[model samples]
Target: MMMRPPLVEVRGMTKRFGALTALDDVSLRLAPGAFHAILGENGAGKSTLVKCMMGYHRADAGRLLVDGQEHQVAGPRGAHHLGFGMVYQHFTLVPSMTVAENLILGRDDLPAVVAWAAERERMEAFLRRMPFRVDLDRAAGALAAGEKQKIEILKQLFLGRRVLILDEPTSVLTPDEADQILGVLRTMAREGQVTVVLITHKFREVEAFAHEVTVLRAGRRIGGGHVKDLTRGDLVAMMIPPMLAVEALTVLDDKALTAVRELSLAVGAGEILGVAGVSGNGQRELVETLAGQRSPEAGLIRVAGERYRPTRRQMRRRRVFVLPEEPLSNACVRTMTIAENLAFRNFDEPPIAVTGGFLSRRALHDRGRELIDRFKIRAAGPDASLDTLSGGNVQRTVLARELSQSPKVLVAQNPCAGLDVAATAEIRGRIMAARNAGAAVLFLSEDLDELMELADRIVVMFEGRLVYETARAAADPHVIGHSMASHL
Candidate 1:
């Protein structure tokens, strides 16, 4: 018996931008019906490699082969024509269109005449053949994040795409939803229906679903093999390090009186350090100082062992994101569209910003739609003004922006304060997920119960000082309350 040729292959692929080499001589092979995972930190060239394959970017060097034949992919359309499809981190569906309409919307042979009955019949049969089902008549915008993601995959399949590339598909999903989606994909791979290529930073997903893995670092493929052959330590060694520390930090309030005095704390990677306090116990000042709203009077802030300032550039570069107390007043611009507000974080970055510093309105709207679905924010549409959204929806918008970055250091101040029970649960789950993914979380809240439930450690804040500290396992509410009222 002869071995089968790889369904997709890249040899000596390289991409460059100006003086920077985004991808350097990277190679990949995907077997038919196989599940492959690409793991990397930000800027590790994972996106560059995929873009080259999808023809979104013309590689500076190397060859792309589909079914052992070389092909020059001109763009996404060309790639799609070659049976390749990509599900981006953002949804591409038209909100007002029904699921059936969106599924057939991309067809080159779409009919101009009446054919709803025939299309619905065809869609019904298509859903029956799949592992899951979605209501065809339902508007795409009305679907949840997990459901929207499923539609994305189903849309590709409906278009007859045999090879699927998914970029962080589970980033916005809850754990159960993530599991369900990945499980379905895994089963599909096992049944030889499609080949799946996953781009993610999650080792748990890779360990559970992927058969083969490739690790990228600094624009180069560093290590890869069968998933069973690798250990967590092996993958961690290939990646990088991260943490957050504040040493002897001091801040002053509006009267220039000391509000945070000689405060110090460290949040290790994958750890949550909760600051427990009453409303006026220096929590606001500490949060403002961390968020760059107020300058510290003294002391040092460090991220990953390097001196840090919370300038926009530094915050973005270091992956330090914040979810402040009052998102509507502090975070969003009331007059701007939801899409425009969501783009605030990456408006100047690529994909969102085309050449010559012009913003891509389509990209902004697409990203906003994605987050809106994921965060379950009830709104008219991405074009809706921020002021039109309710208080909870506004908070969800801010949560979507900050947590979506997968921050290394998350500075959250009463993130769940005004949210409903369900929304609060969602926000807390996202925060915990971020911490579990190796983020250092600095959580400041007045709710002791919330702190005890989610924090790895707790510290009491009173009169501008951390008066008491204890591991969560050993925390005593009475003791902590006493400390919060009177420094001990």
Candidate 2:
């Protein structure tokens, strides 16, 4: 059988950011009316590739073809005109507006005078044709994450986009919600209504919905083929490369409730083991137990095959460090100066301590200055108050302090939760750097995307127990999500 020409194709596409090559000689063919997935690790240039296709970023070198004809897209608007639209990882709907209002808000041809009645009538027809249902009259903000996402996709379709590019569309959704949305899109693709290109790192979604796959690694097209021709192992082998181990660990919350029950996992040398779950699902308690804020009722904690404790002496001796959540509240003293806070881990034992057991202010400030510069922390100086810094800067301070000693084991909880794009990338880079330097990292986060991006393996924690585990290569987001919600 002859193959249908690609609806969208890129040849030798290359994009560079001064020193870093974001996409390197990457070529992909997105088949018409097919569910195609672009899979890769966080920095594998998945988003960059799609953005280049949409003209969000102009490629330094490459050729873009639509229906076998070469064309240079002027911008996103140009791509939209050519039947291409993208749904970002974050929702774009306006909270205060009704779904109907949001659906028509982005059009270029809106009349100066309002025409709600006719627009509503047209939207009703559009919604009726869609596979999913979302109340048009309801406020967009009042809808759940899944519904909001559906609206985002619907908005594109309503705008008459025939080729849809979804960037991590289901990251915030439940397993069932994700399945429902993907299933509907799969149906749309099968029925020849739309060509779907999914940018994701989840194996389960690819196996279940995608017809063909293109895998990118470190900005290059490393591997790809029909979904049927590849296994989880094959995919994992393409993504690339553990230390902390928790065995039969049990811990209680402040109320004396068993918040953590029989949790067992491991992180090898130079590996990140991501713990995923909804908030209040013993994630906090587990981190607390590991950090020594809470004592475990039972279980063994080891470092490099030796039993370990969270005592200051033991942590220092074992070279273990922690970056707890909410650094300002849980990890730092707000009233203290940046220098003082940075000295907390080693004030008494370091060069910061003088001959008579007194802290040398100069040494402390000097060390603080070094760390501040190294971590790129934005601050007045080492003497500046900790509270005066921004959330991202405070996180930087804590990360700088913990990583200073080049720890043998690191426990981090939502290190980039509220940080901006640049800060998040910097912090994640530091964490990955530590892993590369041979630290056993136990990374805990409620963000599944964060886990999928950084972890070598992931295990879901639910109701105080780890119910599911998978290697990054073999992970099934559906299974992990079900385990997180205790649906399995």
Candidate 3:
């Protein structure tokens, strides 16, 4: 038997922004009911290509074929009308509205004298049919990220979209929650209920659910193949080249409701120690304590044979740096210029400030220029406001500011949390460089694959305690997952 034509097809898709060609002669054919995955590092054309498909962007050159019929999607609404649905990384639900109300908010086909009671019953039946566990009467804001995500999927399903596009859907979910969400999507695709186009950086997600893979690099299609036909190494080689490894470290956060308890570990010089766990498992408290954002109340932290409190002055004197998660909120003053933000750590002393306590404008700009070039920060200029930069650029600025100090002990908590593949690689590369330069690095993240690749040793955190530890080479995802779930 012959295969049916692709449910969605793009021919010679090309898009350009000024001198940057975001997409060049890109073409894709997504089969009906196939869990198609688009993988690429940051600055790759994955987002661009998807935007074109969703009508959020208009291609400069190309044709989009839906069900063998050429069509131009005018905008997001038009895409929705054309049986294409997209769920963004950030939710679009209204906080005050009930899940049922949020679901039908934008729809206009409802009866003039609407029966909310009957509607609720109908929604309940529909939810039960799909076997979704969301409480329709609850406010959308009150639900967890996973439940809100399910509501988004159900809304799209209710609209009868044949193709569902999810952008980093499980980035915030726990291991168990992520598995459940992806399993549902995979089942839907396998049962011919919908076609899935997942845009993500996690190779594990692709391996777990995707059937076909398309890889892009630097705004062009680099490779494409069936999931079973390729290896994880192949995917990494195409997406992000591996970085150098790091050592082991530990910590205990006192005042724990149930989080950190008697934690003690050590990281070697020129090594990275990776801490992995499900969110809310004492990771936050540990990072806060290590970064000096919170006092440990009681617990000894030793660095290079000296007990330390990780106070700001002690950290600065010791040449230690902390790359806290969400740098925009925690590390930067958005209203300030790029140069000003870069000077935040050292403005009180020379280079940024002179002996007379006067700010050195020239020195600041000069250093900013050097770091922007060295870190490949995409900014208008040092004078540009910090808020004007993109997510990747913001991260680049953070990395440049921290690593330029030549830190002896670097504590980075989810440094690549919201970054793209390229930005993440750059940050990880700098961390490895720090390790190689005799720095003891603490690399903490929820992304297991990242830790496995960048860490020489790994430790799992459960309810604020160190439940499991192993060398990177001997680490197993299943064992780690079990530990994360508090089952070990």
The candidate maximizing lDDT is 2
| Per-residue accuracy of model 1 over 1-488 as CA lDDT, tens digit each | 11222489999999999999999999999988889999999888998999988889999999988888999988988888778888888899999999988999877567887498988887788888898789888999999999999999999888888788999899989999989999998988888888899999999999999999989877899889999999987787565433887899999999999999998887878989999998987888898888889999899998986799999999999999998888887888999999888878899998899998898888888999999998888999999999999887888888888888889999999999877898889889999999999899999998999999999999998988888899999999999988888877
- TM-score, one value per model: 0.52, 0.51, 0.50
What is candidate 2's CA lDDT for residue 452? 93
Question: By summed lDDT, which 10 consecutive residues of candidate 1 come out lowest?
Answer: 1-10
Q: Go through the candidates in order and give the C-alpha RMSD of each one to the true structure.
A: 18.7, 19.2, 20.8
Which order, best to worst by TM-score? Answer: 1, 2, 3
Q: After superposition, how far is residue 127 of candidate 3 from its true place, in Å?
A: 1.8
Give model 3's clash tally.
Answer: 11
- Model 2: per-residue Cα lDDT at residue 177: 93
Task: Please list the residue runs of candidate 3 whose C-alpha ends up more than 4 Å from where it truly belongs after superposition.
Answer: 1-6, 108-113, 241-488
Q: For candidate 3, which ten residues in a row score worst on lDDT? A: 241-250
Q: 31-95 in candidate 3: lDDT tens per residue? A: 88899999988778898999999999999999999888999888887787778888888888999
lDDT of 2 by residue, 368-455 (tens): 9999999999999999999999999999999999999999999999999989999999999999999999898999999999999999
